[model samples]
Target: MEINGVEIEDNFAEAFGIQVSRILITAATKKLALVAATEATGYGTSVIGCPAEAGIDGYVPPQDTPDGRPGYIIMICNMNKGKLDHELLERVGMCILTAATTAVFDWMDEPDEKLKTGQKLKFFGDGYEQTLDVEGRKIHSIPLMSGDFLVEAELGIKAGVAGGNFFILAENQPAGLLAADAAVDAIEAIPGAITPFPGGIVASGSKVGSNKYKFLGASTNEKMCVTLKDEVEGCEIPENVNGVYEIVIDGVNEEAVKAAMKAGIEAAVKISGIIQISAGNFGGNLGKYQIKLHELF
Candidate 1:
């Protein structure tokens, strides 16, 4: 199939099931909220090599927030529930509490697992912590040198799909970069979906393991490497394709992931120099949720 003249490869992006925690961080302004949210989600690119995978789901307006402040919605996903709860506690305690005028709130309703994120962090108050009701939501306040850090008592965790991805192949580096930028901008606007990589683009896509190193969990995706096309097996790089950037998406459900991928691919297809749109998968071994690229359109 072709979208806006760009060929859509008949491939699927591999996805795996994992646990996710949705938290809304509020601050005096959107700037502060985003700053705290970004710091907390740093180093959370992939679960294969990193501790967890996380990204900003979106922003919450002040009037809609419990504390009447601008908020950033962040999603942290892990392989298991125990790790998800632990990461949430550490991230919220160190990142949000240390930042000035910042607070966090649980964004999920009727979650399968409730994590005591704020209740655990309130210990920093050392018995001087207090509780309040803001807009019918319970808020826990922890005393700090700057002021009190307010957070919701609990965060909700549920099963989610991760590692959903697609490749944007272009004729040059600049074209690939532009297409990736436009795709991420469009994907970021979709709810319940997030691209965890820096700038929402993965230049160094990887396979399951390394061929040379035993300790390496993942290695370069040789098939898509244009320069190594002559030396690699199963090379998927076309002769004219010089640049390939992958967009990995994580979402609350399969539908949200499909919507984000559809928007991203459509946006990239309109950009000049985009040659083909493809996906990365391990034949469904990695995860059960395989998003077919052509099915999205």
Candidate 2:
């Protein structure tokens, strides 16, 4: 299939099931809220190496927030529920609680697990911590140097989808990067979805394991590398495709992930020098969901 004259490879993006915690972080202003959100989601590019995979889903207006303050929604995802709970606790406690004028609230309504993140972090307040009902929700008030930190007593975690991804092949490096930037911008508007890679773009895409390194769990996907197109056997890089970038998306559900991919691909094809769109998969050997790229249109 072709979109905006750019070829869409007949491929599918394989995605796996994972646990997710959606948190609404509010602050005195949008800038402060974004600051906390960015910090909490930092170093969360991929669960392959990182403790967790996370990103800012979107911004929440004051009128829509539980605290009536400007906030940002973030999603933290992990394969194991126990690890996801721990990640939630650590990120909120260390990142959000330390940020000035920041507060956290549960964004998921029906969660498979409820974590006492606030209850655990309240220890930072010593004996002065207090619990109160605000907006019909229980909140922990922890005293800090700037002011009292408010966190929802309980945070929710639900099963979500992860590792939804696609590739952007372009004529040159600048074109590939620009196309990736446009794709990330489109995915940012998608609710319940996030691109966790740095700036929502993956410069180095990897495969299941390393061929040379026995201890490594993942290594570069040489087949998709434009630089190795001639050197690597069975390479997927076309003759004219000199630059390639990957966009990995994680979301609350399969539908959200699919929507983000479709939006990103469509937006990317409009960029100049975009040659083709494709996806990565383990020949249907891994992941639970296989989203077809051609079917998206």
Candidate 3:
């Protein structure tokens, strides 16, 4: 299929089922909200490498949010519920709750979901913990040196898809980055999705194994590396195409990832110097969720 003259591959993007937590961070303004969200999602590009995979789901308008300030919704995912809870407590405690003028809430709609955010973070209060219930959500207020930190009692956990991605083959590094930026911008408006990379693009993609190191689980994908094109097997660098970048996304489910990938690929392939749109997969050995790109579009 062609989107604005760029070819869309028939390949599928593989995804895995993992536990996810939705966190709503409210701050005094949109700027602070963005900062808290960015910090919360930082270094959470992939669960394969990072402790968790997370990203800003989207922004909530002041009228729609509980705190009446601009808010951000971020989703954190892990291989299991225990890992998800640990990472959520660590990241949200250090990143969001510590940020100035910020308060956290359970973004999950289900009331029965376990919420350990406040339960874990209330220790920062050093025995001065106070709890309040607002609009059916429990908020724990912990007194701090700076002020009181407020967080919800429980966070919602659900099954989510991880490792949704697409590769951008471009004429140069700048072109690839520009195309990736456009793709990120286009999909930022999509709900329940996020690209958790440094600037939302991965320049160095990894392979499943290493030739020299027996202990290494993953090393660089040498064939896809432009600098080592001459030595690696299956190197397919087209003339004038010197750079490749990958856009990885995490979402609430397979359909969400599939929809976001379609929009992302469409936006990316429109840019000049972009040659091909592809994806990363484990040859159906890893993930339980499979998204067919052509069928999605």
Name the best candidate (by TM-score): 2
**Candidate 3 lowest-lDDT run of ten:** 108-117
Evaluate model 2: give its lDDT: 0.94
Better of 1 and 3 by lDDT: 1
Q: In candidate 3, list every pair of residues with a backbone clash.
A: 115-154, 115-155
Q: What lDDT does each candidate get?
A: 0.90, 0.94, 0.82
Candidate 3 segments whose C-alpha is farther than 4 A from its true place: 109-112
For all the candidates, what are their Cα RMSDs to the real structure?
1.0, 0.9, 1.9
> Any idea what lDDT model 1 has?
0.90
Q: Is candidate 1 or candidate 2 better by lDDT?
A: 2
Q: Clash number for every model?
A: 0, 0, 2
Question: Candidate 1, 71: how far from true, in Å?
Answer: 1.3
- Candidate 1: where is the Cα deviation over 4 Å? none
Worst 10 residues of 2 by lDDT: 109-118
